[model samples]
Target: MTRKILHVDMDAFYASVEQRDNPDYKGRPVIVGGPPDSRGVVCAASYEARKFGVRSAMPCSQAARLCPSGIFVTPRFEAYRKVSSRIREIFLEYTDLVEMLSLDEAFLDVTENKKNIPYASQVAKEIREKIFEETRLTASAGVSINKFLAKVATDQNKPDGMTIVRPDQVEKFIESLDVGVFPGIGKVTLKKMHALGIRNGKDLKDKSLEMLDQSFGKSGRWFYAVCRGLDDRPVEPYRERKSLGAESTFPKDLENSEEILRELADIAEELERRLLKKPFPGKTITLKVKFSDFTQKTRSLTEDYTYIDKNELYRIGSKLLGEFLLGSGKSVFPIRLLGLSLSHPESSSKITTVNTEEEDDLFPSLF
Candidate 1:
């Protein structure tokens, strides 16, 4: 059976919301994040800011250097969550099979929707119009027979646009798209493919399955399947988070231990803020670091203690780094990225005893 999926993505969501609420921010370079002087990173950037080469996850200091006059605003999650709920409500009115990808994006499986909208393109249009009318916000919608194509079509025309990939046109559409446009293909993957002389979907489609497998292993199989417009991923309404974490790539690598600690501390603070909302009372804290050479390493510690403070996280993370330095016998040169993650500890009930022994076994001291 053919499935009709509609992907709706808001343009520059966080920055856009800030602009919408404040009239003065409209049509201006607005960035959502911490102050530039504090070594913060840009969480989101408005389209106006994009003109100055500003982008999300780019260091706030670099963004300021790019656009000195850009306005900076801390994220307002509560406000954005309220807006997200309103949008989701609008989506549910058309289809019960709604899968939210993030706070500002979702996919609607309208094949079995109440409206019985025979044409997926019509459903996408109506949804966009209604969203604009009710929320005074512009949305881009992609209509396709499946999720992957629908997502691609939605991005074809951005900032209040819509695109449709009909059943008959799926093959041509997939063939014409750039390989980098496919989900899960990051900068590193793209670079590797470029070195292999693969530039676009057509080039990727030309490669043999064995060649892909030899290069990317299991992910190669997924790439081959998607190149033919085939994806079996379903749109489930329930939200299940597989992982929650935060990471930052610095504009330039830093070598000083002091600077690295300061940066890690900032990232830990952001993680705590996000975790507090979910009451992420997990016992495992993992530190992920990527060196200037692009070598990545992870060190996890499961504690008898639960923590959500920057100071505690920094202390543990610093210890892990120390251990790595001692083992590798190589000093950290320039730091590229730092990440922190937490996982739920095994437990039976609220009154259960803490498994101190199990915790020790889970995290062995590197020293």
Candidate 2:
């Protein structure tokens, strides 16, 4: 069976919407995030801002430093959600096999499309055109045989562009890619691969399956498969929210115990707000912290009761934080970031294994 997948990603969705609404924002650096002085990060940055090294998830203060004249716009999530819903409607006109990775990006199976377009490339182009015509925003699409290649292709030529990777091109394409381009290969994993002298796909493929398994443990098999252009994951129209989380990076490293708890209290409120939209009713509460030096750690607690109260979330999360910090309930080191999330549904506590769908570390969730 012919498998045709397309990954579509909006170009700076939040920033673009801001620019599109305001004429003066065009051709200027627009960073859609919190105030520069605030302890919030950039949610999305325009391509103009990106040229100055500004990017999503970067601290707003740093983004300001990078793009001195960057226009910082507070996120209008409701507006973005409306645009995202419109885009989803556009995708459904082509195929129902649409898997939304986030509000601004999705994976689409256009192998059997409503338009009956024989060439996947043409379908991708049509989708991009339709998105622009309707939303007044541009999109990028990558067309290939599987979700992996399709997602990667979407990033190749961005900002209203489309790329097609044919069957014959798949092998060469996979072999020529940098190891960092593969999904799940985060900065830590990429650094480890570099230390092991596996810089590119060719180098990674040279190692035997046994060697890879030894090196990467469970993820080794995934690496062993994708390096040779092999991925069979299908596009599902719906996906259950594995976890719902909200996190923030402080403008200054927090050292005071009171201050830390206050921040945790705020995060719990935000998480509570997000969860209320689509209640998870989870039994596990996890706390994530990033120290001043960028070292990260997580502590979780599974209680008998379900997660419903913000006060309880803060109570349990603070307890976990206290345990992690240790010694008189005070921190020896400064804390720069704090995150709270709920997972492990009441029915089951099993939450370890992560596929692509489960591995969004960037405040990434619909729930």
Candidate 3:
């Protein structure tokens, strides 16, 4: 049986929420994240901001430079999470096969939904309407036979839009797609593909399997299948999160070890709050550092038992940061980002014991 996959993404989630809560922000360029004076990145940019070449993940400072008049606002994650929960409730009304990707996006497998909806597109339409009716926010949806096509289609007509790719249209759709737009093809990979004259799906299809394998290894093989619209990856509704983490980029890179430790304390506090909200017993604590030069590294330590003690997390995090600084020999002074994550809890083992096939049958392409 052909599967019915729907990818739903909120349009400018954080920015839109800000605008919705504050009528004065409506129709104006809103940027959410760290302040422009700090070394932070843009978390979300409104459509109006995007027109000024502002984008998520771009440096907040750069975004400010791009749109001098843009209103910069800090993210209200709690509010966003509340909306996300509400949206998930709506998804559950139709199917238990909903796989949340993040606070702003999810993929639903409605092939055997609770509502017994016959048309995937109709399910998507109703879901969007329900989301708007409850939250007063816009969502874009893509409906197709598999996750790949559904995800790509979601972006075709965005911000309160829906696009459907019927099974019959899959082949032609794949053939005409630009190679750069295919999932997992980054700038570096795109450059390599261009050198090999693989500019589009047709070009990718023309390459021999052996040649592609020699050029790109396992990813090449995966690309070969995806370019032909043959993605069988299941939507795994039961995929357990292996780790929970939070990170922050500073307004200014930290040059002093004391300053770094202070920042780590604040981050640890935030992590504790998160753990309290979604309590997890993780034994391993990992610290992430991104230096000013764009180089990144991680250090971790494991305990005998899982715990979520704030002081312990902070102690471990600070120790990790101290060790990194001491090892640096005063060289790598400025650090752009710092992060903390908890993992390797006892519950994770139990996650794998669930019936994989059953989960797959109910949900597709969760990861």
Tell me how many residue pairs clash in candidate 3.
8
Indicate the residue-level lDDT of 280 in model 1: 51
lDDT of 3 by residue, 68-165 (tens): 99999998889999999999999999999888877888889999989888999999999999999999999999999999999888988988999999
Q: Assess each prediction's global lDDT (C-alpha) against the native.
A: 0.74, 0.78, 0.77
Q: Residue 147 in model 2: shift from native, Å?
A: 0.5
Off by over 4 Å in 2: 244-367
Look at candidate 1 and tell me the lDDT of residue 63.
Answer: 95
Where is model 1 more than 4 Å wrong at Cα?
244-299, 302-342, 345-367
Instruction: Report residue 251 deviation for candidate 1 (angstroms).
Output: 25
Candidate 2 positional error at 41, Å: 0.6
**Model 2: number of clashes?**
0
Which TM-score value belongs to model 2? 0.73
Candidate 1, residues 130-239: lDDT per residue as tens digits? 98888788899999887888888988999899998888998888888888878656454566587788888878889999987656544677778878888878888996
Error of 2 at 99 (Å): 0.9
Deviation from native of the Cα of residue 208 in model 3, angstroms: 2.2
lDDT of 1: 0.74
How well is each residue in 1-367 modelled by candidate 2, as lDDT tens digits?
8799999999888899999999999999999878998767777899999999997666788899999999999989799889999999999999999998778889999889999999899988888999999989999999999988887888788888888888899888887888887865644456668888998888998989987765554467778888888899889788876777776556568888888898888777667655533456578777877777767777667777764556778888887887546456567689867778887754444323211312335344211
